[model samples]
Target: MGFFQRFFKKVEEVNNQEAAASELESELYVESPEEEAMNLWVEIAQNILVNSVRATGNSVDRAFVLVEMREQPSFDIFYQKDGDLVMWYELEDPAIKERIENELLPQAPSVASAVNGNFAEIGQPEITFAQLQFEWATKAWFSHIIREDDAHAKLAKDEVLHNWFNNLSTEIKTQQLDSDTKLSWYP
Candidate 1:
């Protein structure tokens, strides 16, 4: 098996596993608060992506769906077919951004939110980021020579966190979803 072959196979396996899990969940279904929020987030996220693509006239397969962590977590769609970013989601509208951000506030806090404290001031997200960093660093995914305290003396969170983000990007590569679209998270 070559790289692409193995990659697709793994994706198919994951899809199968998810399908099995979903079936099991449906059989034993009980809608909890967490599950309810997750369902809502999934709907909003999908709507944003679909609407953005429709507005831009770009195909999802030829674009990158980025969940940016530097701000209120929202979809950052980018068209990647023409080498340059030909299509970008216009999220500069404050009303639109806020509506999405407010709805997603507690529902979809990401790794970057935890690392940079962008999503919440102080919470479990931060703890999650710390644990994630410790695991990845212990595994030697990237060098953690710089201390977090030292990096925090300057702005933009920490250099060490940035390094971790870059390392994670390398680790995850560009994940191809079942919809044949590329997706990744960034700090």
Candidate 2:
């Protein structure tokens, strides 16, 4: 091949390689912001359930499995079956406590009674990322509970829940940070 033709071919190959590399990098690094938020939500849900269960001095009814809600942020529901009553509890934003009390409770007295009577209520439960996996499984129960039907509302609520869970999880994890490890290793 002629020198100029060979040189041009090599340059074109190099450009193609660079373009492929850029596309691969973008694919590897690009993640949906919603997905990241959902992950944070999962961590938070696990923590709250753990802390709440611990505070109550009762282990989760392991006979039941954790299920995530579809079309929602990181929230899960647990259920146990009895002769005539099916018990259900959802782990979600702690702020749902207020909503449950003010809105849902009055409308769904049975659900309210189940929540108030059977489950122990712990305010502002704190948990660590490591501890999270031990409490709740990664799979969540999918469902729509009213406002979730609206796309905009669901997105807004999911975002809010994600932020709330992230903040709380970070705070709890930070508190558990090993200050002694740094000092002792350095010393």
Instruction: Report the number of the highest-TM-score candidate.
Output: 1
Model 2 residue runs over 4 Å out of place are 1-30, 60-147, 150-187
- Ten consecutive residues with minimal summed lDDT in candidate 2? 178-187
Per-residue lDDT of 28-85 in model 2, one digit per residue for the tens?
3333444443444444444444543343233332112122233221332222211111
Per-residue accuracy of model 1 over 1-187 as CA lDDT, tens digit each? 2334445555666587844433433333345544443344344445444454444433323333434343443333334332233324234446544544454333434534433442233221211212111111122111111123433323343443455345444543343322332223323
What lDDT is reached at residue 131 by model 1? 12
> lDDT scores for all predictions?
0.36, 0.31
- Residue 51's C-alpha lDDT in candidate 1? 50
Clashes of each: 0, 8
Candidate 1 has a TM-score of: 0.34
After aligning candidate 1 to the native by TM-score, how far in Å is the CA of 181 from where it should be? Answer: 7.2
